[model samples]
Every structure is written in structure tokens, then in C-alpha cells.
Target: MPDPEEPDVVSATDLETPPGLEPPPTAVRDLLAPDRRFVSARRNLGSFAKTGDAARLRRGIAQYVRTGYGGAGTMSRRLGSVSRTARSLSQVLDPGAADRGLDRALLQGNSVAEITDAVVEAACSSDGTLDAEASRESIRNALSDLLGLYSDVDLLRLTDAQREFVIESFVAHDVYRRFALDVGKHLVDNAPTATIGLSRLKQARNYIRQTIAESFRLLREAGQSMTTAHVRSTVANALTNSLVVFEGYLA
Candidate 1:
């Protein structure tokens, strides 16, 4: 069995709903809406990490294959495609449903050590099969890419407290409650100015940064005194590039 405490690398397969919640049209529209898109993707990535069901993975794979081939390319290009789908799903589903499913899937029957082991295994794999070096590179490169995919709105909404809460929950609860909370709050706020695109972009970037920072921090800290080289470097590069592409959205 995998070590109980290790973090698991959530795969695309984790996002599918069981029989009943067959995605309503309203939900789908919310997911596809420009303002909601970033939030949607954030929720979806959290959902995907928890469930790991094949159907969800299929949707992600279809998206991945369609947008860009994964095996070879700049890491950003690959993660950008996958991240978009994650955002869409996050936007479409009820945040409650996503949270519940994720919590159930992750906390089912493992110690923290086990979870950590699973994460290490997943990181080393390519397409769910083990390949240590590939997995590491895939993880680092893809995450760097994924974080880069966020937009200005994404950065604007996330507060430091929210980020800390997300990291805590992922460790204790195995669910990204912050994502759901953010989306729920977003929906309830009902700001007319927030377009689906902007909303989604905002949500997506928040998840990307929080997840990347948390994971990188944990891994870097696990065995030795941590260094900021990779983490800061990655974030800095992403911020720089994002500024180039997302200047219009920035106020």
C-alpha cells in the first residue's frame, strides 16, 4: 500500500460525477461563462484530484489531445490545455457536490503517510504509469506551466488567509474547500461586472498559484533545508510572462 501521509497527485480521472448529477444546462453555462471560467477550472482541478474516476479523466484526455499533444511540447502549453478543462468543470458543478466528492475520495482510508506515498508515485508517472524522472519533470514543468496559465483577475481575488486555509485543508481533509468556498462566494456576490471569462480566469489562477506553491513548498522542505530557487524562480517567470499576456485585465 502507498504510504499514508504522502500527497497524491490528482489525475484527470478524478473529476467524474456518479449517475445522478448529469450536469444541468444552467451549470454548464456557468462553467462556460467567461467570468466564471477561472473559478470553474479551480473547482474542477480540486474535484479531479479527489475522485480519480476514469470518466473524468477521459474528458480531460479529450481536452488535452484536442488542445495540444502532451508527450512533447513546452510544459506551459500542455498544462494550459488541461487547466482550462479543470476551470470549466469547477464552474459548472455545484461547489457543494464537488467538495463532498473530493472529501470522500481522499479521506476514505489512508494515513497521511500513505497519501504522501501516492503523491510521490503519481508525480513519477506519465499517464498514470511509473517513470520517476519523467514524473518529476512532468510535475515541475507542468505545474510551472499551470500556474502561468492564470490571469490578472485570478491574482486580484486571492487573499493570503485563503491560501493558507487551502493548504491546511488539502493536508487535513484532502479536499480543496477554498476553491468551493471561493466559487460559492463568487456566485453569491453576483457582480454584474464579472464576466464568465474574467471570473473563471480569476478562479483558475488562484488555484494554480496556491496548489503550485503549496506542493513545491512541501516537496522542497520534506528532506532538507528548503531553497527558494525553484519556487520563486517558477513564480517569478510566470508572473513576468503573465504580465505580458494579461496586462489588459490588470488594473
Candidate 2:
């Protein structure tokens, strides 16, 4: 008997071809022998990570430090050059430091750009002794670490439509929220023109939707599942970082 959880396999002969598309004859045979692994796997989204937000952030930070610092000698040397206040790199590279620097910035309601800058700076050099190249590398490593955490999820179980839906809803909510906030601020400021042009608003909406769709496609290609919490957090970060563009719709 077929598994109750599995979707019914439809024969290609019974499938109606959409307008303007002609499927090859082999398509029917291939459909009859679909990949069993994918067919049997759960199709719904699951939690991206089992840990809480703080723990997830700390794990990401620790991974970044370990991967970026290379060795204890290098870390020590970097720390020594960066600061005289601390005797060890652990003082700044550990989870406590992540809590103090990145977490603190987040809790203080800093923008995503500010938080990202702060986290990268704190990771690169606690006392700010890193040169431009080193700082840039640190920022790259920091973002990689954070994005890597979410990219670890298995996305093969989800259908393309499901992934698209999650991404679209996430982007829509973020755009709507920012648009509402900007309009409210304009009203409060008594601006000469409180209304944004419809064309500009449409452009902004299209840009955000395209961005979100492309981001989701890349993540899906990388085998990352789009969980509800992960989608929300990712969209929030995007909105926070793109506040200027989002607010530009008002102009």
C-alpha cells in the first residue's frame, strides 16, 4: 500500500499540459518513477534550529571566531595588537563577548546595518586596531557565519510553491510595515507631501519582491529550508538594512 503521508503519484498521461508547453514523451515514464527519497520525505517546513535565538547567535559567533582566527597563536597575536586591555582573545571572542557586543546592539534597537557593523568590528578587533582589509574580511566572515546557520537546513522536502509563498509573504509584510511607519512619521512631521507617488510605491514593491524571490531561490538551491521563524528573522534583517531604500518610497 502507498504511504498515507505521501502524495499520490499521477501518471503523466493523466496530467494536463498547460498552454504553450509540450512535454517530451519520456516525461510520463519519468513521472511514474519519481525519486522515492523526495516523495517519502516530509514536505512541510520544520524549525531551522532547535536552539533559542541567543544560543543560535552565540553558536554563529563562536563558529565565526574559530573559522576566522585560524589558530590560537594568530588569535593571540591579533588580540595583542588590537588591545592592551585584554590578555586573551577569549575575552572578546567568546559567547559572553557576543552577548555584550552584538546582542547588546540588537537589544538596544540598533538598525541592522549598525548591528552588523558593530558585530563585525567587535569580531575583527575588540579595541579597533584592524586595518581596512582585515575589517572587510571580518565583515564578510561575520555575515557568512550568520547566513551559514540558516543555510544548514535541508530544503529538498519543500515544494517550490511552498518556498515561494514563504518568501513572498515575508517580503510583503516587511515592506508593508516599513511603508506604514514612514507614512506615519511623515504625517507627524507635517511634511509638504505626505503621499508617495503610486509609481514609486509600485517600483519599491517590485524591487523588494524580486529581491526576496532571488534570495529564496539561492537559499533553496543551497538546500536551505524556509522556516517561519527563519523567514521572519531574515526579512527583518533585510528591512533593517534597507531602511533607506524602503523609506525612499515616500519620496
- lDDT (CA) for every model shown? 0.31, 0.32
Local accuracy of candidate 1 as per-residue lDDT tens digits, 54-153: 2332232223222222221343453342332222222211223234123335544665344334433332333431122222333333333323543221
Which 10-residue window in model 1 sums to the lowest lDDT? 169-178
Model 2 quality (TM-score): 0.25
Identify the runs in model 2 with alpha carbons over 4 angstroms from their true place: 1-160, 163-167, 183-196, 227-251
Best by TM-score: 2
TM-score list, all predictions = 0.22, 0.25
Q: Summarize candidate 2's per-residue lDDT along 15-114 as a digit string, tens digits.
A: 3431111232342324323222221111100010111122222222222223334322443344332222111112222332234334552335555456
lDDT over C-alpha atoms for residue 247 of model 2: 28
Model 1 vs. true fold: TM: 0.22
Candidate RMSDs in order = 19.8, 25.0
At residue 17, candidate 1 shows an lDDT of: 25
